[model samples]
Target: MKKITQELIDRFYDLLSPCRLCPRNCGVDRINGELGNCGAGLEVKVASYHQHFGEEPPLVGRSGSGTIFFSHCNLHCVFCQNYEISQLGQGQRVSLEELAQYMLDLQNSGCHNINLVTPTPWVPQIVSGLKIAQERGLHIPVVYNCGGYEAVSTLKLLDGIIDIYMPDIKYSDDQCAEKYSKVKNYWSVVRSALKEMYYQVGNLKLSRGIAASGLLIRHLVLPNQLAGTKECFKFIAENLSIKIVVNVMAQYYPTFNAHKYPEINRRITLSEYRAAIDILKSYGLDAGFQQTIDTLYRKAIPEWGEWS
Candidate 1:
């Protein structure tokens, strides 16, 4: 693998002055401290940093995934669990050097990988930080944890940068996406995004039982929304190879603005989750982990920065 260097990092930072970092195409001049739809500028704002154990097993193996939750999101989903950071913009802005230092600190603390949560809008800035961390001997795999609505061109730039591509295939229908995420063509967009991500990172690759590279697609089963889930899994089975890791998430609870929307106002029932899992099994796509009912109930809520 090609080593991440400071020169590559500098070029990435240069792209952010006129930020076209995400699929939103806000094109706001972030260099002069202007905010776009993501509510972020040249500087990266982080909500918190910790060794997060709440992620999928491989990513959080042994020590835990070194999670750095970035504030604000390109897609403003109504049921966002981390609305305080994503919508309310409650985080402190840090320089690229400072962000890189944080990554090294996490590694020094025995983290498995530097898992960047909701990092679409700040890709360039994060790359810059990763390069800096690399210079300081940060060698752990980098996980690109994002919402599925990503730009193909933006992902192309991240070709040799990211190791593991962990994205949520949120919705498979335009109506559901439009109603919940306010994105008009989210279905097509996410499909294209996932294809590109799969192309970049093939099947899930592990070393010593820890994820080192490849794609791990996540899907949260929502209440009264099996149509989207069925279509999503079908697309995954047909288009992508069956070797890819798929996490059938069953922990959908009413959060953020979900109460305002009647369709998603309640938690997903046991039947709903089981049906999704059954569909996965029926399709002969059995290459990933399925959370137990107890695991879902216990770890659904955020643990407020606790590792393990």
Candidate 2:
């Protein structure tokens, strides 16, 4: 009922032939089992799906957000917390029908929304499943939770289908992005993607204190300002309004191969978090959330499942 038209679905699946779902543009025929840079094959692979409360406030209202964690990300960050799923591809390959069932099950369990994490590569398949799920009385809002790297053309296919766009503004500098996430054009791509997403779903809107639709950005403050928080805040304030909800994440630690880089080999200091908060205020970006620095001491490992 939310405009997942047959024509739109068809156009999205066509992208799979050349596999230009994300910015990689691998051109590999994913329909024929050619793997792309995202490490995903033609099959729809899902790491897990559950009512997760570890998300943002509005998304975690009384019933948690129904999060379907997709394996293999478009931007495989070297310091990825869910390295097992994103790097090693630890997930179960599911058919489009099965994926729809998963959505229906989550809705039945009283989830706030269907949160699709790292879903770029499998957009076509996800949309197909969404069509079936919507037809089967699945009406919960669909949240496109993704890494910053996205293609505008691919996102256009999801125009009316996706209600919430929660994306990360990983780096303000392309050089830092290339070094950290192996993406040289990340800054440029994300800017366009964020603009398109904002155009689709304006600022964050809530219904009875629950997020009904909008764009919420997550900016993970890395050690020694490696995330370029200053420039990021400025860009968001100038381009995308300062009133946009932004989650200033402070839970950064040396995860996976992060230790390989000395600059990011340790947890961020309280001063660093304060600096980011200061920048946020300087930009008049008050509509967002920030984590307590004390939580970083608790050793919050990623909730993603094991490699087995």
Write candidate 1's Cα lDDT for 159-235 as tens digits: 87888999999988888888888788888889998999899889888788788899998988889973378888888
Error of 2 at 125 (Å): 0.5
TM-score of candidate 1 on Cα atoms, chains taken together: 0.93
Could you give candidate 2's per-residue lDDT for residues 22-104 as a string of tens digits?
88898999889899998888889999999998898788789999999999988878889899988889899999999999999
Question: Can you list the residue pairs that collide in candidate 2?
Answer: none
What is the C-alpha local distance difference test score of each model?
Answer: 0.83, 0.88
lDDT of 1 at 153: 78
lDDT value, residue 124 of candidate 2? 90
Q: Global lDDT for candidate 1?
A: 0.83
